[model samples]
Target chain A: MGGTAEAAGGAGAPARRRQARGQKRIEEILRAAAEVFGEQGYDATTTNAIAARAGISPGSLYQFFANKDDVARALAERYAARLATLRAELDTVARDGRDLDELVAAVLDPLVAFNLAHPGFKALFARTDMPAGLREAVAPVHAAIHGRVAELVGQLLPGRPADEVARVATVSIQLVRGMIPLITGAAGEREREVMTGELHVVVVSYLRRQTAGAGEPGRA
Target chain B: MGGTAEAAGGAGAPARRRQARGQKRIEEILRAAAEVFGEQGYDATTTNAIAARAGISPGSLYQFFANKDDVARALAERYAARLATLRAELDTVARDGRDLDELVAAVLDPLVAFNLAHPGFKALFARTDMPAGLREAVAPVHAAIHGRVAELVGQLLPGRPADEVARVATVSIQLVRGMIPLITGAAGEREREVMTGELHVVVVSYLRRQTAGAGEPGRA
Candidate 1:
């Protein structure tokens, strides 16, 4: 939610009605923002265009957002919230004590799906020129996701040294994150299918090497 | 060489001397372009800045490159030629009938070194907004490298189908290419070394799985 919407509460019944409407309008604005930002690069997207797409006046848009950069930061916050929800689900998967491939698939499947569903993800984060503040705002969430994965690897491989588990987790995350440009953005249907399946093989192989170092491994 | 430099050869001694200077100037300009492009980014870089880094007048720079885009395309071409030379070395490794790890080491070692030596390799090609012409000029070289790796995989696995070899090759390249940002840019020294070794394991394990299918297999 934007600042204005959050500020709209704490008065009478009529004031409460206005606050509800303001919050609804903010949701509409964020929806439209995703469309415009994803359809065009971030630099090409404009606040006026976002306002227009939301079917709200410029003043109404301004009531919620200071400008385009504000819109981007708000959107990033929205995305971060969604990722937090997914990570809760991922926690359950990590605790399931499954094989390495099963655990990885549980993590990557929803992640790639979430990325595809949210266009602003690739549009904002993939851009070389996305604002420094916006990147900073999102970095902690990204690191937290990596940290959780590292801890899961630690649990799954009890005898391994802590440092090696940390390294495995880092590169494992990198391997998946590295594929996003192809997976969510540029890849076509056939290429998508191939890369998605291959991503599992790549992730599992890397993980097994870590756990079974100098020893024979089990199934995928 | 720029159009003007090519034309200079049709004249006499002065023309030959000018052509030599023009070629030298082009190399100097390219080196400077790489530094600026890697240090900042493509859109932020200007021909004037590249010229200044090269310690040449703007007029001299323009005599070779028509504009900034022109300069990027030329650098991409130069990068392509270097890749061609590396592929020939890779071809020899494939023919030598070495172990899987040995062959993969021969290929990835030099490729990673090349990427580290030229930061512009990632800065230019990895960009979301790289010009279509520059990308097209580089695409063939990239495809050729993938092709050679596919063929090498085919020779290494005598009974593997060509298509399986091809698929493994595609993902292997993607895995390595995907890691380039972490490998050459963001990752620290310890992470870099860990990734470099882990990359070999990832490649070799994936390759082993492809050849052996669901069964246990020999080591890479």
Candidate 2:
């Protein structure tokens, strides 16, 4: 893998060594940034503290980041990219030619998986102190994720307008996203199951209605 | 009217008058706390900063609050009580035998109105860093809201299981709450309208399906 090769290069090689050192430093800074930002929060998190956590001098930190805001923005870009990757996986699921229930699960499962896999990233994104530039930068990826889900819903309901499908898609996504805290145990296990099971039923019922229409012949 | 006079009794009058004065200070502190926490954010805001914003001495602030955490918890309790009041209004609406659409509107309108009326409080509650005590305390209100909506949905479709009705209720509420940011201009007007119309259509269609099922001989 690229990551393994890059790590093996280390800082003693040559020209690539300099690049690797720079990249490694940035990674170290980002790890520290996430910890500090998660614990003390974004606005309270300082560049100096990030530097200290990374065991780097403030000047070295400044060489990579203009300020704390810069580091946060960089972190957001990385997070957006990661989300984009997960969104792509969701797109794959959407195209799996499954039934409506499977389709809905396809769209939601990756999100749940991503949140479980990298909770710190989710925590960082959840913080309200995120910079405007970072938010704006992240918008397109979020929009792309939404657009892909909407497109999948449209596929499942061939008769529905794209816009209409997008609407239902947005609402369905909203339903699951709202359950994040519960799904992740912030709301406790019993509450999580209650919410998740409820969401499952609602998604299925809503999708069935959208596809079957009101009082469609022979419909349950 | 009596509240105003009782609140005014907090003015420095005498030793006996200290009680009202202390109460007024706490109220002032809480108001200041909400505004600061809303505007500057929870973690970024400081107790001294809130005291200054309240136009009170730090000592006076301390007299009413042990720390910013205490003030925030108090403010959260106050906001939770306001939400409860709003829920009471929704309960009345649910009991009034209104049409399905009207019942849905009744539940949502008050919540929207409350957010508009107390943007500061809304912002504070929306923050992810809210104390665990505050989050746990609000869970019952959320459950009650879900339960009331479930009952109304059952009334609207007389034969659905109480659990199914509750699931639909939770989905609907989550749909609205999730889009609050979008509806309030965080996601732009066109997006808001499309989402609102889509959710309206979904709800209507789903309810129609349930009602139709009731008319079928030997069907759910």
Candidate 3:
């Protein structure tokens, strides 16, 4: 987020201020859209609902986006931006000498929580019916996340080829991607806890095997 | 699939014959629905297309199914039936006393392939847009699969609570559920191969840990 926000260098002051305001307004609309879309789901949520949630006039909403799909596209772009920042942060964490388990927890906690917190994401990407373009728009962000995770895994298990670590990273991410919903979708607190704990075992156990005879503590 | 298929004994002979024909027609229609749905996807697929694929008139199609959703429901039923067969076969494998890795390879290979082979499933369940009922219809089958997997895990790791094994099984299954798409949706064969191998690393690694010190060969 640091330096991610940049003002136009050559633009006149007024135009620059107006552009900043435009960007802020767009961000608000996307946030509101995410909330509404998450709660009511894509099919039930409407532009008016988003505008209402965003505390903007319908006209103001139109100034930024023409319809719900447009808002969704904008949201995907915002998610990508956030993901880029997350990746940068993750890169720094990997570079630091933090314990790999702690580093993984630091990175994955917020990452998966991002899904649980934003119902709109599950509604959009999880659903089979959202426009393919919306999922496609965000693919790069997912890929970027995967790439960063692979880098971190490679750093931890230094002896392994980058390629092997990458495959392991993809498996880990995909396993979590599949498991998160089942956890979130669990019938009760106990069930959610059980699933989460088991998932931790699944991931950690897999990693220990991959890093066995090589990296870090906690190996048998 | 034996006793599951039966003509009413009390009914007149002609009526019984008609019922059998009706059942056969339904199966054909569902198979055709799967092909069309797999190829074109859920939303893009039409009832007419399904009917044509099944080689029946619109009226004949309607006699069995009210609409596309009905076809999807029936397809889910068929999928469940197939899974039940799979579970039974897996149960035998579990009881037959084989190497755990070999057993796992035998079970998971076809199970994952089932998803890749059936594009209609990806079209239906994979879609963010599919109706809740559609997802719900298949939930029991998934649960059943989880239950069977857990049972097998418990058999391998005797003395552990069935519940814990079941939970681990759920994690493994969910992990596979999540990985298959990434594998099938992989950009190229090479990427897919890498992902598949890593997933093998993941599941086997986790299982080895779960059953560690309790069961199987090569335990050190």
- Give the Å error, residue B5, model 3: 17
Candidate 2 positional error at B137, Å: 8.8
Better of 1 and 2 by lDDT: 1
Pairs of residues clashing in candidate 2: B10-B20, B10-B21
lDDT, model 3, position A117: 71
State how far residue A152 of model 2 sits from its true place (Å): 4.2
Task: State which candidate has the highest DockQ.
Answer: 3
TM-score per prediction, in order, is 0.81, 0.66, 0.77
Off by over 4 Å in 2: A1-18, A32-60, A83-97, A126-173, A186-220, B1-29, B46-60, B96-100, B129-176, B186-220
**Error at A12, model 2, angstroms:** 28
lDDT of each: 0.71, 0.61, 0.67
- Report the C-alpha lDDT of model 1 over A2-43, residue by residue, as the tens digit: 532333335642323447887888789888988987787575
* Poorly placed runs, candidate 1 (over 4 Å): A1-22, A43-63, A66-69, A126-134, A159-161, A185-191, A214-220, B1-18, B57-60, B127-134, B157-163, B186-188, B214-220
At residue B195, what lDDT does model 1 achieve?
69
The best-first sequence of candidates by lDDT reads: 1, 3, 2
Q: Clashing residue pairs in candidate 1, if any?
A: none
Interface CA RMSD of each prediction in angstroms: 6.8, 7.9, 7.5
